[model samples]
Target: MTSKRRATSVTGNIGESVLPLVAKQHLGAINPLDILPLNASSTAKSPDFRVRLHPQFPAAFRNVTGLTPNIAFNYWPAESKAVDTRGNANGSVDRAIQQLGAYWFGRHSFEPNVVGYGLVCCFIYRGTRINPLQEINFHVVAPASMSAQTSLLRRVRHHAANGGRNDFLDELKTDGSQSRRQLLDV
Candidate 1:
């Protein structure tokens, strides 16, 4: 007897394909090439998309920082039952945070010229047979900084004081005004 293969593994692939289209439709002002995958790999650890600051961003901000702020988008599809657990949201958020941490501390650690890095945790869920909407959540782990910026220092101090948990990002995610597309604008 022939058996059918399960669709669990391909859910993320589907999300990867669909998210760029969603982004293009919603974020038409930005260049489509910027919203691209990190690499050609299909590994689970790879970030789904990376969006760089558009040229239209505030000239002063870009000049002062001397680095274009970028956001890494990580897609987590909820339809994959094999990976979906009761604590899936929490797990997914943690994983996204971990990936950002790895990038900041690993590849970009010594890059003094680099200014800021942001991360977006995208949760793609099917609300109906014909509707699949994504809940895009974001956190600015590394705020933009010029030389001797007190704000960046203050953020570091706050994170150190709070035992490294970013309550601010959590609060931002809870605030309904900041949508996924809006986060990319930063």
Candidate 2:
């Protein structure tokens, strides 16, 4: 298979493997009826799988309440021409940002305070130039939360012409080690 296809296949296996584990661990916390394969159809944007919280979930999970879905995921293989290649992240990272952003919106809607928590998880990669993004390399899980603890508006709005802009993208273009480390810690 082509590298891209191989990468996708491997990633699929990983995702397939995780769903049951998550379902088992979450038990009452996750909505089994709606969680798996949330809107996988090609007509619109959706997560590879979503973590739909139970309706009775605690208020600690809530924020302002605009009503966005809770945590969701978008899967990308860690292999070559996928999430990373030759030890450097590739365009797939960009796609994750976009997709995860969309999922957060779909979960959050117009209300910034949705009284529910949401997070993004990325499968980390360790690779070499020879094997590129192949799974033969190590893979780690990194988490990022869009919960109220981190202001989504502020994070995305930093790019505004407002003098206070954090040069967010620039920081990313430069050495993103600090920001990346922050995500890993999440």
Candidate 3:
């Protein structure tokens, strides 16, 4: 398989294996029925998972309107070396964000019951003696508002204008490292 396909397969396997544990350990109780696969046929781009309310779920899980809000999850795999640098990691994050943004902005005849979305990126370090699974570190990216989209676009434009170099993602890389450490500590 191509490198891209291999990476995707690894990412999918990790998502399938880890997401349930993550939800249970981090987000309190979650029923199996609450998780669904995104509909790939309808959207050019889609998240890996869609989380909604289960019929028998507790009242505490419901929103103010007493309805379950949908959450989108996307999985990504990254090389530790690539993510160590702002420029290298920027490409990966930008691509993921662009794809997610497309889903956010695209017109759909049938609207999905989604409220927010997140990207889960797993970074594997090079030449590590430990198992790749153990070495993998995860980071999540959730844009707070449409302003993030505009900011990303501005960065893209700036990069293009400056012959494709920008430090816009410098802080993001640091934030990812801190987030990963925090998650592992939990």
The TM-score leader among the candidates is 1
Best by lDDT: 1
Task: Put down candidate 2 lDDT per residue, 1-186, tens digits, no spaces.
Answer: 113434444534343344434334542333345445545346434345544444433232233332333433222111112333443443444433434444434444344343122323333244544554434222221334454325444443443435322344333323353333223211
* Segments of candidate 2 deviating more than 4 angstroms: 1-17, 26-31, 34-36, 40-45, 53-97, 114-117, 120-150, 154-185
Error of 3 at 54 (Å): 12
Better of 1 and 3 by lDDT: 1
TM-score list, all predictions = 0.42, 0.38, 0.40
Ranking by TM-score: 1, 3, 2
lDDT by residue (tens digit), candidate 1, 26-134:
4342565556566523332434555444332335345544555432323221111111222355555545544443333222334422222444434434333344333
lDDT of 1 at 11: 40
Candidate 2 or 1, higher TM-score? 1
User: Cα lDDT of model 3 overall?
Assistant: 0.36
Weakest 10 consecutive residues, lDDT, candidate 2? Answer: 73-82
Model 1 bad stretches (over 4 Å): 1-12, 26-29, 40-46, 55-87, 113-116, 124-141, 144-186
Model 3, 4: alpha-carbon shift in Å? 18
User: For candidate 3, lDDT tens digit of each residue in 1-186?
Assistant: 112224444543443445545445544427665555555565354455544422222243343223332333222211111232233444555454434434433321133222123434433323232322233333443333344334544443454456432232232234453211211110
